[model samples]
Target: VTAISGSNVSLQISNLSTNYEQLTWLYSAHQKILEWEFNKTNLFKSKFKNRVSLSGNQALSIFNVQKEDSSTYILRVLKESGKEEEWHISLEVFDPVPQPNIEIQKKQEVNNICHLQLSCKIPDQSITYTWYGNSRALAAGPQSFMLEITVNSENHSTSYTCEVSNPVSSKNDTVYFTLPCQLGKKYSWGWEGGHRVDEVKKDVGIL
Candidate 1:
């Protein structure tokens, strides 16, 4: 059996002996009769039913089918001597399930640098990753699990989330960071600054 077109499938059988004089094809769905072709044209078609064709040369083609329509196809050939040979074909369709996983790490901490290293752990099946803050995407990224926040002041007290998705499913994770920045005091020079400047100048002149 071979697929002749996107919507069509072809089954071929060969016979070297003159034993078979006639061929008949029959099909069923969930054990219910759906189509039967006997000594007719090579093709069978119906708008309300699936498209199946039988050629004069003992080839069968089924088209426009769905997963639920899959079943076993039985072909019988009758010989001129009143003997018959039978063959069977089974059809199966499959689709993959989408993978799900978390996008970012569950917790994070910010340092005095006001920077943070955020991470996400996505399921191995995920294909892409998206990070968001306040419902906006974090920008360009490739994978779903691994990410770096680059640690910035804006990350403080912000509710960040990572959303991971693929063709079939999606998953997400959120974390908040409150960065601790310790401010230092700046020294100011007054009359002390003027006295220090004069003292330094006098010492330099004396030397």
Candidate 2:
């Protein structure tokens, strides 16, 4: 029950020994499959060195194997009523690595200073940076920076971060800002009209 079809690996032997007399396979740990089974048994010492033959063309096809070619297969069927049957196969290999993308930026309006922004978009390459606040470690700028907030009268609320890594993959982003207020209405500075002493003496007040 060995299955992997991309690098090639398929072993299905349901008792195949109907007058067959040779079969071998191994890859339990790789050594180049014992140097490809000693160059296909050239040293001639038939304990099936490098394990041999999966078929001689009677419905068994083994071709261009890879994925370490897996291991554990032995079949030496010598039947003429002298009976012999041995079969076993086990191989599993897979490759996968791709799933990373994180971006964040939300902390707008902080007069007197206060800003935090970060970004991370990975699909191909070019990523390696780290910055975290509230989680500590914040001192590595390049992707973005302009934080200088200083208008907190004290109430506690300050955090900023931006961490993105690369060796394979990593992502992070955070933004925070505090200190900017206008609640209802506190704006009064005008000069739309001057004093009027009886409407400013009928208009003598235009100086």
TM-score of each: 0.38, 0.22
Tens-digit lDDT track of model 2 for 1-207: 333223333455664644544333333322212111222422224233333333333222344444455455443334456565545455543221122222334334465443323344444333444555555775554443323323333532343445544332233444343333211111111111121112111111111
Top of the candidates by lDDT: 1
lDDT of all predictions, in order shown? Answer: 0.46, 0.36
Candidate 2: what lDDT?
A: 0.36
Q: Which segments of candidate 2 are over 4 A away from where they belong? A: 1-107, 111-115, 124-131, 134-161, 165-207
* CA displacement after TM-score superposition, residue 146 of candidate 2 (Å): 16
Candidate 2 positional error at 42, Å? 12
TM-score, prediction 2: 0.22
What is the C-alpha lDDT profile of model 1 across 1-207, one tens digit per residue? 322113445655665254566666656422322223344444233331446655555567567545454557767767779887777777553222122222233234345344334555543442466767556777435553554545456544355565654433344555443332321121111111112211111111100
